[model samples]
Target: MKSTARIKQVLVLLVGVIAIGSIGYQLIEKWTLFDSLFMTVTAISSVGFEEVHPLSRAGRWFTIALIVTGRGSLVYGIGALTAFWVEGDLVNLWEKRRMERQIAALRDHIVVCGGGETGRHVARELLRTRRPFICIEIDSTKEEAIRKLGEGMLYIIGDATTSDVLHRARVEVAHGLVACMPSDKDNLFALMSAHELNPTMRIVTRAVAHDAGPKLLKAGAGAVVSMATIGALRLASAMVRPNVVDLLDAMLREPGATRVQEVTVGPAVVGQALSELKLQERTGVIVFALREGATQRHVFNPSQERVLQAGDVLMGCADTEQHAALQRIVTEG
Candidate 1:
């Protein structure tokens, strides 16, 4: 910010000096506007071009003052510019601008707050799923780690709980946000701020404590997950149902590998029986579980005679290409 301010200040001063010099020449020497401008440019730039017209006694003194002031300003401006370059401020500024443009161009992207382990994992999953997203991390030290999440990663280095930072991340156009701040309060604040900025966007917040889940939910977070609780559950599952755990692990272990996904039944596929779609045969997407549109309860291994309705969610397993085909036919058709 200091570097940016310095550059702005230098530019403003230079412009003001040039303008004043041009007007001075026009008045004192009675030169045309073009001649005055040319004289001013040459004088300020130290080109040492001859005078456009013979100078009066007043004009000579005015020219001397202008030369001294112009040279001083140019020297100061050069020093500031050199500092900006040597400090790498110029490159940083350019990259920040490019990132902002990329972020602004996004639609339906996800915003991930924090650059800790949780946020890192979430970003990796979003990357593997091919979702366009941006991250906001307050700690400057965490910036390098965040950038290493992928090539050309989009992120903001600022407090995510603030509305200004969220706006910078384009919360208004985002489809979802993941709040994974280190503390429950920070995550809660981010969730509320994000909701205020984009009421329709789905928000999932991390719970630092097991009991914070309900509070986050009441605060308008679409869902809340406790890392400790999930870890405990996974441990128990690994011991009691190792095979099932292994299967789930295998599904998520690699990019383009078969994985389970939940997609809402779109209007085009609504009212159609499972058998009529032949989803497995057509797209290799098997619909194994159905969440009824009205009931919101899962019916595992629903019969072929079951009909898909609006707002119903289907959970199925398929590889990347197969899932894309399934989404195009059912969720996007």
Candidate 2:
């Protein structure tokens, strides 16, 4: 349980016990409920108030019992309140404000929704790449688990489906959003909310069900990857193409990891081809393939005859610096 909830529970239990004890005293001692409650409160608080009436033998014994129980409850309640202020309520509020300030200053950062296995993996990759990002998780336990693998990551403990949480995440300024919540419905909802918040924002998500791709896309996801299907394909590839699988594993584990990027054609590269671009010669990068409209073509060793178009996407292997250069060449052209 979170400290806040636990403290609330303790306080409520104490209040209930005190209420019941006061009511019992009123019934047995023939005292008004208010008087009985006031007597119990003073005795428990050790406030040294005068007695309401004379005490018979039975009343005297009852008073003794009430004093012991009431005093203990009073002390316990005060301690719990003190601890709540010091450790739970005030601290959480302070952290929340600090996180908000940090998020407001972020730009070109990724927003991750959910902290499940897939989300965690995505976060780890972002951390490894030293990218700026904020994670949103509904589950406290899962949030704790992700925090354990800390890399100065920021997190907001709330549902990503809410506009308030997205706003706090600085969605309008974020470069992209990754929705990896467990349910396809949740991921789709989060994508929709994020897109509505920032129309031009890039959103990538995972769908639990294979057929949920179209729905997720309609909900504003730029890319919807199905984990189930991908897992199946990975298993099949590992069995039939062990060497290929091993190569991929090695690429991920090695330092200076390689990532495949799609560089779009920019104004400056209007009439340029993969061969003419000379990315390989200039940046030690390779153009693996090219896409124009609905067609994809492998241009491992492209010829100068190929012309670049405004909307064409180039698939290439490169590092961060090369990728940035590719972006500059395509967009700033």
Candidate 3:
């Protein structure tokens, strides 16, 4: 808003100076409109151009006043413009508007609450999955750093545990939301607020307290990941299954490498069989498991004869290009 106000102020001052000079020239010197406009431009610009015609004494005094006033306004306007660009306000304003427009146009997208360490990791994973998401962060200072986590990142600086902020993120149309606020309470509140705004939205929340998981789940979170529990489990796995851990970690961190991901079966392909789809032949995507749409049960190493149902999730390993193909097939049929 400050940047926009500065821009408006500069434009208004410049227009005011031009109007005053142009009108004074025409009335005092009895000059043509074109000549008056030219004199006004040259005088304000300090271009050192001669007057269009000889001037009366009154016109001379008017010209002197115009030059003085125009120079001051021009200097002030230039300073404002310089500050707008040099201080990064111009870029910030542009990015904010672009992010807002992109978020508004999105449907079936993800909303990530917070921009802390955990939130940044979630954002990176979402980017890897090629999902459209807008992050809500309370700290405006962290916005630029969070945006550096991925290209085309959209974000808003506002409290995530509030309904107004969630509404601004278009939560009603969002497919899922991840609450990664600093505290379990903040995450729980955000989960409930988002659920209230869109009851059908699938929410995954982060919990730090040992007892907070149950409360978060009860408060409308579809899933709650306790950071301590996961950390302990990960440490155990790394100790016992070092090779397995390294392989999985390498696959996840390597660019353009095959990684585990899930894609929902769109309604258009509800009755299709795995053999009919031939995902490997068409998109080079491998489907190793099918999560039933009705019961949410997992079937590992699904056979070619397995028929897909609406909302059935396919878990597989795919690279970026193959993942894009799978997403298109699932979402666009």
Winner by lDDT = 1
Candidate 3, 1-333: lDDT as tens digits? 576699898899899889888888888888888899999999889899888899899988888888898998999888888887876866777877888788889899999999998899998988876878989999989977997997788888999999999999999999999999889889988998999999999999999889888899899999989889999999999999999999999987877547887899998777888888878888988899989989989999999988889989998988877887998887767
Off by over 4 Å in 2: 1-98, 293-301
Ranking by TM-score: 1, 3, 2
**Lowest-lDDT window of 10 residues in candidate 1?**
250-259
Clashing pairs in 2: 266-330, 268-333
Q: Write the per-residue lDDT of candidate 2 for residues 79-181, one digit (tens) a residue.
A: 7778867886787687768777888899989999998788888888787656799999998878678877674569888999888999988999999999999
Between candidates 1 and 3, which one is better according to TM-score?
1
lDDT of 1 at 38: 90
- Measured with C-alpha atoms, the lDDT of residue 221 in candidate 3 is 92
Give candidate 3's whole-model lDDT. Answer: 0.88
Worst 10 residues of 2 by lDDT: 293-302
Clash pairs for candidate 3? none
For candidate 3, what is the total of clashing residue pairs? 0
Tens digits of lDDT, candidate 1, 30-138:
9998998898888889886888888999999998999999889999999999998877866788888898889889889999999888899889888777779999999
Question: Which ranges in model 1 have alpha carbons more than 4 Å from their true place?
Answer: 1-91
TM per candidate comes to 0.72, 0.67, 0.69
